[model samples]
Target: MNLLRSQLGRPSRRWAAIGIASAAVAGLVVSLSGCSSSTTPKAPENTVAQGQWPSYYPSDYGTIVDGAKKEGGELTIYSNTDQENWAPIFRDFQKKYPFVTKISANNLDSDEVFQRQLSESATGNAPADLLATNAVQAWATYNNEPGRVMEYQSPELAKMPDFAQVMPNVYAISMDPVGLAYNAKLLGGEPTSIADLAALVSADPAKFKNKITTRDVSGSFGFTVSKGFVDGNTDAWASLEKILPSARPETSSGTQIEKITSGEYLAGFFISSAVAFPAQDKAQGIFKFVFPKDGTVVLGRGIGITPKAPHANTAKLFIDFLLSEEGQNAVSEGGLTAYRDSVKPAPGRHTYGEIVDQAGESAVIRVPYKITSDADVKAFTDKWNGMLGK
Candidate 1:
């Protein structure tokens, strides 16, 4: 079977459906912000609070931070996270091990990173030593191509609480949940839940009819919402899509939160308090995050080792470092930790569980032991387009 063709089988235009929505999303942000009287507040520092993160994996053989044994090697990674956001973390890694040298990094979208890894594997020249991104993408890739990622099962893996340890190959160091975010001054405060918020939108269509925005979940969010539709919340999608004509799907949750704060968009969908709260706290735009009483989506960010990393040993060490308490804290940035039994995010618009539900990462749907299959990936893209009228 032609894997590439199958992967590309989904009409490209279906993927385009989301792009059309983005323009509106962007417009909503700009228009709403213009109406708000609030001023932007200062953002927070990157480090996480104390004792917030437990362990993402189990601690079978005690600690995973085996720093006592000094080892050295050059390593490289390719990712979508901008160099600026990631550079600090890399610097921290370097500070931990002054001996390692020649570290290289690249900034690219997850799709590009996945494609590059595939290309390298085809030519027996996988250059990067690590792979990291949001769980949905990584999970899909691993599912589609089992054994493409090396499995170290970090000694810290055992320390990870059960929910966080649901899958192999992909280990979460940080996570953010999806929920409704709104301008506090514009709507009194963030709605208690998505259902309530949706009701508010429907009741006064002119108020929020075209004021909300969302992220382009074409690959992951689409899969997430599809799974939600399949679940007992059969009406969840329709409930969600009911307001679509008025909703805009944007580039990311962060952008929507920014827009909402500025009063550009009064409300946003497919967002996590993780991004919203910080912005809200910074008083970026008088915003707040809240979950629908029913539930929402929880998405995680994590790291994985390439099956053919040039510096296998160093990559393994870095993975272990991240799973280590110190690294997890850095990733959490003093917010909600992803480890099992860890402290949950302070009361807000949503909870991690809500996101887990929306993203279909909860108890029912098994996160494939491997990534998604070539055929399935294509099916997902095509189905997304079908929904978008592509």
Candidate 2:
């Protein structure tokens, strides 16, 4: 298996399909905005007041807000994130739209989110109004089918960077950086990069054996980040060759964090800041994180509304609000790295800008949103597992 063959390639069929539709939607959105034409939907007379909406929003953006309130004021989301992480965003969203009476958000495995969505939608049962995950490969496959994702464009698109909009309606809710985490009390010195960690492990293999952990690349989240790291810096494979012998791969970040905090594990590589940042306070200074100086893989948590969403309007509102400055801040508060430049920095919270500033723009490796061919995935997985001696 050649790592060079796995570098981010052409946009997948799903991306191309969505890209074409996005162009058409852009033209249509411009024409429809502020249009009093009979075909245009009108905001209901009882629509809630738009308080402090940014000046850049289209004049007719309120129609969607009004429509959402009429749709039973409920929203359900299926995502691969903890409920605690969603709490802040949920609290702030409902505060903005008091009309929203209920929100049901589930935290499931990365693949489980799509499995449930596909299964539920097939059985003619209502599925999630929105879907969120970091599994780019899974998302690409899911969107290959027509109508799997809604093609609506957000009014806040202009405010975001090109990378934020992964495909048509799909957007990145957070830009999370993957890094190394350690047990501060147990680790004698700070290791700034994978190579440094490898050097330390080489110094005392017995002390690190089975004590260092990383994501099991069999899973999408693990595979994506691990592959991203290697694709960005080929030198990572050399360091990993030295470290994997002493490493124990885990299926979840929670387990890695828990063991590291308890000193069961000495350190973990390719750990997500989204999971690690929030755990720091509870760890009481036991767990610490570092953005690898060699290269930092920044992964975008992909989110989009489902075409069959029971509450379509509400989902639309949610997506737009997430891209807004306030929503981005709430995302950061929830331990996710907010990507919007307008978002203010909070103590101990990370933003994409901050990561780039610290790691150097050239050192920031963005995991591209593309479909990995099954053969390619298998080849990569086989080689990766072989390295881990699995």
Candidate 3:
């Protein structure tokens, strides 16, 4: 469960080996090391009723795994997950399809992952078989460039809410809810809304000056989250701009968290609560978080099938595995908000449903990414940069 925390709005991933140990109980010893590609009994027909099943219940699990084994090509993955946090998911995947030999996983930000796929296409190559990213941002970054990402409708699509399923291929596997991360001792009191945050910083720019962390609105993650904030609240833009004068722009969430933990910074906006809270617990600091009452952007860590995947069948199987029930268990244990309501993400972490239940549906806004134009990106970039004299 160890994770090398990194910031969003930039390319990232670190290697962290996950050791799935076997149980000591005589009757139940589970091994996570090796899996066989050989055919097994056909899995049950899967049908997930909305709000009914805890995870994606595939009716034909064995069939998919066996078919993938037959393809027998390494399944290359470019994702937002670091190795340690992703090891459990890969470990479980390997256990189910040992015959595949290898699952090549490399972590990258949504922009970089898209660029790699785009570059591979230009060179008449397909090195990556799958992509796990922030779907909203990926949509903007890729813009559905031909041959970059393939559209394969997963049956699990029907199981998820319409909002979560942005494209046939780019669908959310996990939810990264944006929230406030503040040094409890520094922030006179927690700000509940964007307006509250604006007032807090504007009142005494001197105290928060250079101590408030934010992201430049140009990058993929920042752009997507900013769009959501602006769309969700009328005062959001001004609220964001007001903080710029006293703000310290950071590229990574980890850096923002580190600064706050060290008392160098008082607070940061849009720190992925799911990512920050866990690291906070481990660091044993006074760092705490809150879901913005006015609105909170929930970034979807989505997955897509590569257009020219060397192992197409294997990619499909891996996709199904990720959406499967056990996969959800891996996600929860690995540390992140579970995408589905039925999922019980690691006990302490919150579920998408739980967040929605407490914040109200209106408060959980998906990052607005449908607007993908050069002018739009430039406008956002210019506005942010102008504020900082960048």
Per-residue lDDT tens digits of candidate 3, residues 208-280? 7788887646556665676677777887777877777778777767778789888899888877664576555
- Candidates in order have lDDT scores of 0.52, 0.74, 0.64
2 or 3, greater by TM-score? 2
Q: How many backbone clashes does candidate 3 have?
A: 7
Per residue, candidate 1 scores C-alpha lDDT tens digits across 1-390 of 122211111112211111122223222221111222234322232242222224444543223333323333466776544332343344445555444544566655545667778887888888778776554644565546568778777766676655454356667655555566788789644475556666777777777756877555454544453344334354555556545556666655667877887777888765645455556646744777765445554455556788766677677666766666555543443343344334233222223444454344432232222355557766654644444311
Residue lDDT tens for model 2, 1-390? 122121211122111111122223123221111111343233211112234467788898888877887898778888766554565566666667767767777656566678888899889995589998877777777777778898888888899988888866789999989889999999877898889899998899889888889888777777888888988997988898888888878876767878999999999988777667656645667888888888899888899998789899989888888898878876776668899998756564568988877778888899988787778778877777776633
TM-score of each: 0.68, 0.82, 0.79
Error of 3 at 267 (Å): 1.3
Candidate 2 Cα misplacement greater than 4 A, ranges: 1-52, 282-285
Residue 283, candidate 3: Cα error in Å is 5.0
TM-score of 3: 0.79
Identify the leading candidate in terms of lDDT. 2
- Clashing pairs for model 3 are 7-252, 7-253, 16-84, 35-98, 44-59, 45-59, 46-59
